[model samples]
Target: MKKVLFATTALIATAGMAAAEVKISGYGRFGLDWNEANDVAGALDNTDATNITSRFRLTFDVSTETDGGVTVGGRIRAQAENRDGAQGRATFSSPQFHVAYGGLRVNVGNIWGAIDSAPGLYLNTTSVGTGIDGMGFNSLAIKGAGFDTFTSAGVGRGGIEAIYSAGGFTGHVSYSKQNGTAGTSTDANGVERTALMLNYSFGDYFVTGAYQSADNGRTITKGGVAVEADDDVIFLAGGADFGQFGATLQLAQTEEADSVTLAGEAEVGAASTVIAWVNSTDIDTGVTAGQTVTDGTAFGINYEYDLGGGVTFVAGYVNTAADDNDNSVQAGLHFSF
Candidate 1:
């Protein structure tokens, strides 16, 4: 990341305000992605199983410190991505504004929800999971849950959140509301969500717990159809580092399903590392009677070689738990400034 000092002479002279600081940072990644599922026949068929995947992102962070020792800041990002053969136009995201004092911080707009911010919730991979683009993030315990993270485009979750950290303990809470079109109770798109997360660390070990509830059920599309959302979810994760090796166990339960993931990372030599994870999900068949839901396990492995100067070579393979047991592989370069 690089920082720039803004010329705020006018503000300093007229408003008696401190000069604001701006930081610019981001990364670019491109790779080849091969998916066996894409090679299938029928409506989902793809003549070419391998394709290019790439993303370019730039983030701007602006902040200023007040005389009262409070810091106010906002973040916005511009990003574009190409997956398979479909390319997305570059777009700027809505700003996330924040205020901080001491160990407490509050954020509004495009907020990152508590569950998404909890430690150990994501595996240590190139982009937080198996591949450059997380290989669909099948290894996550909350793989199918609707949670908010930092959005790179569009008006993400318009939420408000508070986070606090002191010593080895951290806590976060978030709330969001989305009012879509009105409909029946089971098909309503209007929803409200509240999430909370707590974490504690001691020595080389850390544990985290998070919970989220959605009122009116957040709407999500499945199999090209909008479906009822999960009403609530609970997540728990624990991890520890032993020398150059680290491992984490995470569990997530929702109104209709439960999932567990075990992930590990190991350092090899001085510039190489390997990360792997296994995830299993079990759905309550009775609840999803008409839906095509299945219980299965997925696993993935990722390898990275550091080339210094914020550059790395990354490769990964994943075997999904779908009925077909499809698989994928990816290789690429990732760089940040």
Candidate 2:
């Protein structure tokens, strides 16, 4: 009787151990940055600028496989940022929820855009003016232009998407809608908006194209004052990887203007470097936006070091110049787990 009881207890213990698993992890970092620009509009005042900024992230996840061949899992994340109280915000950021089943992944809540990728899942050091900073997705200004094609850098704003991956090939498609108050239309005049984007990735190559159109209107105050304005933008990007390096190029054109970006990066040890050039011109390329890029170029390079246990050191530099030209500098650090 005693031997039988011990065997039953051991079996129950083994079953309990196999039933659940929990993981907890997070990371944070803080540093300083500076910027100086010549002949550029809306540039940050990085002169004599010094402060401490940090990012914190936490993730909880669990997975299980049924008696059949089905598997299911879910994860949640919370991110926080701070900047020596000078910035006055400790907002939680990053993809908030994620789940996967078989070859499909359904990001049901706040999540990183499926289309966004970088060397270390950190920032973008491309655009001299408004790139993704060395810590996250693409330039928000560029990606947030009321478009439905790019999966958005972070958060759905409220939407749905489906993705499938088989062997080394993958494909995805998504749709979303947005609305807003008066006088705040970004792509158009009013606030109603819709976006569509599609893409395919195989092996070390990817290609994506997207389109966005918005409702917009303006009030002309006299004579036949125009009361509305309509706008739309189309974007395309493609790239390929060659083991130790990769390259990507982007083009964005709107009813009123167009811009182009060329980006590439290489990996070496614990660090990687990135460089990009952009040129923006109005519908008429000859019309100068004053010293700004009727035809311009920007370049940047970044080095990253993982300090173990979820800490990272990131340093970067950027220069942009148009005919009249402007140049600037930016560098900082970030941490997460």
- List, residue by residue over 1-88, the lDDT tens digit for candidate 2: 5335544554566684645334455555555544343224664454233345455556555455566745555555555655432544
Give the Å shift of residue 137 in candidate 1.
Answer: 0.4
Count of clashes, each model: 0, 18
Worst 10 residues of 2 by lDDT: 135-144
Give the alpha carbon lDDT tens digit for every residue of 195-309 in model 1. Answer: 9999999999999999987866644554555555545689999999998999999999865568999999999999999999999989755453333334799899999999999
Model 2 misplacement above 4 A: 1-26, 37-48, 61-76, 83-85, 92-99, 111-144, 147-156, 178-196, 213-232, 268-295, 306-311, 320-328
Candidate 2: Cα lDDT at 122: 21
Report the alpha-carbon TM-score of model 1 versus the true structure.
0.89
The Cα RMSD in angstroms, rounded to one decimal, for candidate 1 relative to the true structure is 4.1
lDDT of 1 at 34: 92
Error of 2 at 152 (Å): 13
Candidate topping TM-score: 1
